[model samples]
Target: MSRLKLALFALIFLAACRTVPPPAQPHSGFTAEQQAVLRQIGFQPKGDQWEFGIADRFLFATDESRLMAAQKDSLAHTATALVNVGIVSARVEGHTDNTGTARHNEKLSLERAAAVADALAQGGMQRNRLIVRGLGFRFPVESNATPEGRRENRRVVIIVTPEAVA
Candidate 1:
């Protein structure tokens, strides 16, 4: 009877011992000011979905040269703002009007995204801090049926987030 009681007590003690996962580490990237912008922009880290943005003025440009300048400036500002807060990495997504062919638009969108990424790098962002993507006309914010709306739809969005620090 004594042996059986000791065995049960040992089993219970062993069962009570458990290994808990380490707590989530603090995010290490953005400055305080930039962090505020991220919070305002609704950047949540729980899921795969992240928020990005595009400028209204950039879409109104008629020539590629004009578009390039606006895109560069926009991305630079975006990166600066994010880095200031704590963003260590970002993804730039480019969108365009439906007036062009799919292939042409696709290439143009990628170029636009790359241009933005370059601008971000110039603004003190690191080389590995960015990822560029071009969605073309497939993901339009506004209807492409009208010239005005199409212009508004052509843009690049920057998604910001901090690097993983264990």
Candidate 2:
């Protein structure tokens, strides 16, 4: 009886001694420092991509692709951050509200993207690593029916590709 009791106790001890696996790390390609820097500068993580953006009103006047002086400064700082972190590839995309013909919007959005890409290049990011696109009303973040929604739709998005931080 004593031997049986001791055996049962040993079995229970073994069952209770399970080693829990370590906590799972986030599935992100960026290092902790890079993530911190991006988050601090208003970039948000979407899966493996990091995105930063602002509405068109803040950066451009009505139908104008030229970025304001202050907006240029802001984007330069953002580009500097990317260069500092050794980001290898980034895409600068422009979007516009559906307030005009698709052809017009497409041209305007492309100009906007080019303007932003130029700013980043001026701030020391390699020109070759920058990809520019003009989505034009085709990928609105909000409805075009309301003024507020239209404003939201007129924006630029910068996405750091997975190739970044290499």
Cα lDDT tens digits for candidate 1, 112-163:
7777777778877886767888888898888988987788767777665555
Best by lDDT: 2
Error of 1 at 103 (Å): 0.4
Query: What would the TM-score be for candidate 1 when compared with the true structure?
Result: 0.63
TM-score per model over all chains = 0.63, 0.79
Q: For candidate 2, lDDT tens digit of each residue in 52-79? A: 7453223344587888788888878888
User: What lDDT does model 2 reach?
Assistant: 0.80
| Residue 121 displacement in candidate 1 (angstroms) | 0.5
Clashing pairs for model 1 are 29-86, 30-85, 30-86, 31-84, 31-85, 31-86, 34-85, 35-85
